[model samples]
Target chain A: MRHSLTLRIGPATFRIGSAWAQPIDQLARLYADYPDVDGAIADFTVRLQPTSAVRRWVRPSIFITGDHGLADAAPMSLAHGLLAAEMGMNLQMALGWRRHLLLHASSVEKDGRVLVMTGESGSGKSTLAAQLGERGWRLMGDEFALLDLDSGAILPFPRLVSLKNKAIDVIAGEVPAARMGPLLGATAKGDIRHMVPRADAVARMGEGGMPALLLFPRFGSGPAERPVGQGEVFMRLTQASTNYVALGEPGFAALTRFVAQVPARAIDFPSGEAAIAMVDRLWSEIA
Target chain B: MSAALLVMALRDPATTAALDATGWNSLIAMARAERLIGTLAFRLEGLGVPDAVRPILADTRDDAAREARQAIWEADRARAALAPIGLPVILLKGTAYAAAGLPAGRGRFIGDLDILVPRDRIDAAADALVAAGWEWVKEDPYDDAYYRQWMHELPPMIHAERDRMIDVHHTVLPLTARPTPDAAAMMADAVLITDGLYMLCAEDRVCHAAAHLLADGDLQGGLRNLWDIHCLCEESSERQDDFYLCLFEKAAHHQLTAAVWRALRLSHHLFDTEVKAYHVPIEVDYKLRWSDRAFISRLLARNGWGQETRKALVFAFFVRSHWLRMPPLMLARHLLTKWRKGHRPQ
Candidate 1:
């Protein structure tokens, strides 16, 4: 490894090392606002190295290895090294993290209460979260909604909001140019870009809030809203949680408390504007 | 390294209170890498951990406890599957430790279900397992043939519904290996811990663990294996007088005198495993003194030491493991085949 960097995001921290300096340099630049970790003990580690010696110089490909790497995962080309590093960090959190129950959802805070949104990959959760962050809502997290296993509170992660495919251009049109990293093309998921979270989100990453509402959002559909039953919520959240099975009993208790205490709805919207309006209507009704 | 410190603390609870946050972090990471976090959590349950790291430690413990419970359940499932075969199934390694309620199994992670049947009964056992919905994990013809022809265990079988693995072994080591221990003798000495469950006797248990660590396999996770030897030795302190005598006698019978002696020396040196007076006279000078230094460094190094320094040492140990397993002609042929295929058995 030639270069390394460590960043603390909410309760979790990451130590990432790379064979090439370019990825680290870009990461340092993008994550300049986040706090440095306390010490050498990071929650997870990510290593990005060339596939082989000859490949180091000749059309180099970056292979990822770390404490939580999958045994047969394929390597990404050096051009997508940053994406590979990001995926590696996420992989560790998804597989190894145990202190908190992680939801593969986007979250935002309003009036001291957190609203969580989760969906399948192509759903407009990231795009919606990015838009809401610009519109007075404090972005709590993008990839994971960290739920404290003890308190059942949603801790803020607020990492770079990954905007993919059309979402990149959609968010780009709204956000000022400086907040976005360079556009990455042809990723495993398609063209992707990372939007630096709002400064407020980074500044207040330590704050955690009680869960108020859960929304299962579906994009490019006729605008509709339906109530989600408690049983359905529990089953869906178990599917959404990366550490649910590993956390075992504690995870079950926390998730059960969440499903019972919080209200949930399934929302379908044809566009981001319609989604935002529906969310606002829903929030006002709760208020 | 903090890993070594964690092992130390596991032996003594008072040492944990003094560990700083950085130390705790490193210790936790090392424990996770070595698959011993649950073991540490169990050992430290009553001890006072620092406020900052206590929650994480508890979480790790909970996770490991779940895994241990699952392992027990899977063992029960395997027992049911083999019950129809009506043969004495000898549980080996981690499964045996857990089943026999040994200290070494307290927080250990059991990977696969390993059982030993008589050499003549292996085919029947395999047939019973397959009939019970256990399918061969490896689809490759070459790998399947290789295991059936040369290896000690059947091609690992995975229960289609349960998704757990069962490795049915006729003996502890490959048949072609240099040390041809009397399997019949070992099985005859197995103690029946519960209905239909058996474990190797204490002396044979220690010898088999040593042979597995030093002679039969590469030392990728040798530190954890050494810890097992340490616990097993400490457990036998009550019978210290006969422990070493039986250990040596078993070692000699198995042609594993050198392997057992090296294992004991390393365990004693690295972990302060108690060696009784009777065991003190065992030959330690037969192995190169320089090799001792290399093994100590390579085994304890936290990171993968590259090909030049510690990596070379690991490679040498790997080659030696193969050398001990096969005759020269067979070893050469096996190495060439493995090298050409770029595949090493997991």
Candidate 2:
């Protein structure tokens, strides 16, 4: 608890405490534009500390702990401490948070309507959402899509878009250098760098948008579009949601309403350009 | 003062109305950490909160309510599974409180289902539970053997599809423990709440809570258990004479008179649990006098955050828990084996 930072993202707030100042300093600089929590209390907490007293100086590894933590997760090196802190915050929200139906998805909004994309790793949802933000869409969130359980709206959580491996270079080419955090190399998930969201995204983090479309995107596949049914979407979203079971009936009702209202498609594209084109075509038809 | 605020709020709702957003947040966080959010939420009903803090409390209450509902379903499912096999499942602790509609169960969170059958019927019941799709929680040979041999219960079993666990206890304490409580007598005194479900009678329930708090657990997480005793005592205030007498008889019968006496004294000191005059026997009074002083400091110091300031006291109590359970020789061997296994390479 040496150095700490508080970040208010959309509806939830996180207090991240660190034993070392390096990770805190990096987060403060990267998240400078995000708003502070309205109240003194943060919804979730993340602690990044040395695994032991001696480990503080000797090849320190960041041990993540919070209200809700995995029992036997291994520690991350101090070099990846920032990522550890971020993951810790996400884990707390996914497991402990109850106000919203949390979906492990990325979202971008246009004209008060949001499009959500979810899939497994290497699905290109994060990369596509980042690319779309550069063009005209307002990046709503990358790591989690906060679905209002009662209102059926997508609350904005535009934290820094975490770009890993080739996606870091791809986003770097489009976004200016000043907006990028230090490139974190040799992370567990490959080289990861964070891109500060567009100024508008940070400014409008409190805004909520109605869901217009849901996309299950697959990368490295020949271009094809298939409509997803309500039942399939329900099952897939349940799998994607972290606290759906904990939230029980309320979570089920909210997700059921969302699937009934939103049009879903599984789009497979070989490259980013084709993915964008396919999204555009689907948007036109849906609109 | 922070440590007392949550309990005070639950005892009196007006205390919460004066609290600022920060106070409410800390209280909520502490309640969540202790798994007492539903209890707080239920107690706060009709007592207004600030608009900013209302949503947070509402969300917490919803989650807690969902959990409580699920607990009821689990108990029903457990009955369905075990009833046909003729093992009498006497619901214990949280599930028992909730199922029997006791005051202590309102807005409480039930983790795993605990049921007691006759000691001789333990194996037959375990087989029935397995036949009903509950499998041993631990596949490790040593851990499985440890529970089966030294422990009172089998290794906890989880239903294959539901993932809910059932701790099948034939008795309250481990078999190797110094005090071997007469499980048959306790079962005989059980009151029939319904045809299949039974609960420990009022005095027996109070005694069991005391024993579980002071004798069974390490006392690190006994705050909730102490609260259970407090609520049970308050609920049966009309029968205080019978309750106290029966509590004493059960404690003496189990040879846990000291443990039960300490539980009552602490509950009275901490939560102002009411008891008749001179309830503490003169013999146990000397032991409890210094214990009361030591525990007062440690218990009062614990805030919304966990109790970490009194590490020595916690450790002492932990060692005492083991010492009470097993003789010195067996305890040393058990501790050694545990330490070696823990240090062994994975």
Best by lDDT: 1
Instruction: Provide the overall lDDT of each model, using Cα atoms, as 2-decimal numbers.
Output: 0.81, 0.80
Query: Which pairs of residues collide in candidate 1?
Result: none
TM-scores of the models, in the order given: 0.91, 0.93
Question: Could you give the DockQ of candidate 1?
Answer: 0.41
Candidate 1 Cα outliers beyond 4 Å, as residue runs: A38-40, B1-28, B40-52, B277-290, B304-309, B332-346
Q: lDDT tens string, model 2, B12-69? A: 7778888875577567655665566677877887777776556666777777667667
User: What level of docking quality does candidate 2 show?
Assistant: acceptable
Displacement of the residue A259 alpha carbon in candidate 2, Å: 1.8
Count the clashes in each prediction: 0, 0
What lDDT tens digits, residue by residue, belong to model 1 across residues A1-287? 46888878888777787889888888888899898663545667678877776777899888786767776889788888778888888898898888788999999999899999998888888889889999999999888999988998999888788999989888999888878888889888999899999899999999999999999999999799999999998998899998998888888899999998988999999999999999999988862
Classify candidate 1 by CAPRI docking class.
acceptable
Highest DockQ: give the candidate number.
2
Superposition error at A204 for model 1 (Å): 2.6
Error of 1 at A141 (Å): 1.2
Question: What are the candidates' individual DockQ scores?
Answer: 0.41, 0.49
Q: Residue A198 in model 1: shift from native, Å?
A: 1.3
